[model samples]
Target: MGPLTPDNYELVLGLICFFLIFGVLGKVLLPRIERLLAEREDVIVGGAARAEAAQAEAQRVYEEYRAELAAARQEAAQIRQTATEQGAAFLAEVRAEGQQQRDELVAAVKVQLAADRVIAEAELREDVVQLAVELASRIVGEPLGDLPRTRAVADEFFERADQAAGEVQGSGAHA
Candidate 1:
């Protein structure tokens, strides 16, 4: 160390080496790494967007299904109401038919009773006439066998019946 001075030759050589190495790496390896990173970022963003779209589609489908279910329930209720009304109407019609049948039966019974009463009255009149004719035969001490005389006796009996009916109505008015 006779003259303590620094040499610039080695420093220049080191700087030159560093520049050459970095320039080569920037042109080849660095660009390839950057391209890989960009591709990875694009893939992540695309995946996130697809997941959001799928979720929205699922929500829309669920809403549509709920609406359809509600509509079906309403339709079922309407059908039940209609059936109930029809059943009630049918019952009313059946009741009306039964009532009509009952009325017809009552009318038929009344007609039959009236007919029976008329037949019994006719028989009673015939018996009364026979008894009167027997009494007349006993009083006269002879048989009255003429048809005309029997008709005359029946006519007298009817005249007596009309007189009795008039007396009964007169007594009822006094009561």
Candidate 2:
């Protein structure tokens, strides 16, 4: 062969060597690289799927938490309502009991006042009767020895005074 141009033998040998190296790269290295690329793709896709699944799981958990929270809040509200109702009922019972006690106290005071009025009226009548009897004995210049007759006269006077008071009260009401 010339210095720059290869002869026929050298060219044929170079062509055969080129074909052998190309065959090795295409048949061995190319398939191994394709397999590695396929495995990497599978891993990436699996990772994406796992991420989606994890997100779905997280969403489900959040929903469950929300539901539980709502239920708890409702339960708290119900408890508050029940307690408020019970408190109101208790207050009502206390008010009613207090009112009943007040009524009872008022009735007792009224009864006591009535009894005191009766006693005072009786004492006043007795005093008035005694005074009238003394005045009559003094005016006549003699003792009125008839005690039963004097008491009967006093009873009659008291009845007339009571009737007169009743008539006055009735007339005032009409006016």
Candidate 3:
């Protein structure tokens, strides 16, 4: 036999050793390794499931938040619209009250002005009558002063003058 070839007894012993080692690895270490691999697979799959559940929960919460936000925005818009309408109504009411007050003030002022004009006309007529009496006394060269008669004459003269002025103003207006 060649030097590379084993003897029959050595070959039988090597075969026995190989069989023993293979059986030990198959019965003991192989099962342990398979159990470890199963555990690792469970960990990876469970972790992925948990991550997916967490992502689903987060999406639900985000959707809920968006819905609430949209509701809040709509509520705020309604509030603004209500406030604007109320403000417009209040402005209109205030403006109407102000206009009423202005109209009343104008009417009162016109009434006061008319009363003042009548008072002024009466005072001017009295003053004119006194001046006429004084002028007539000076021109007649005596106190031809019958006070009642002189007042009556001045009143008649003013009535005629007022009539002529009214006629002239009426004709001018017509022209």
Worst 10 residues of 1 by lDDT: 1-10
Give the per-residue lDDT digits (tens) of candidate 1, residues 127-150: 888888788888998876455779
TM-score (C-alpha, index-matched) for candidate 2:
0.62
Tally clashes: model 3: 0
The alpha-carbon deviation from the true structure for residue 44 of candidate 2, after best TM-score superposition, in angstroms, is 6.4
Cα deviation in Å at residue 5, candidate 3?
9.2
lDDT tens digits, residues 45-97, model 3? 98899899999999999999999999999999999999999999999999999
RMSD (CA, angstroms), candidate 3:
4.0
Clash count list over all predictions: 0, 0, 0
Model 1, C-alpha of 169: deviation from truth (Å): 9.1
Residue 22 C-alpha lDDT in model 2 = 94
Q: When superposed on Cα atoms, how far off is each prediction in RMSD?
A: 7.4, 5.0, 4.0
Between candidates 1 and 2, name the one with more favorable lDDT: 2
Q: Model 2: clashing residue pairs?
A: none
Lowest-scoring 10 consecutive residues by lDDT in candidate 3? 142-151
Per-candidate TM equals: 0.50, 0.62, 0.69
Off by over 4 Å in 2: 1-51, 135-146
Which segments of candidate 1 are over 4 A away from where they belong? 1-55, 131-175
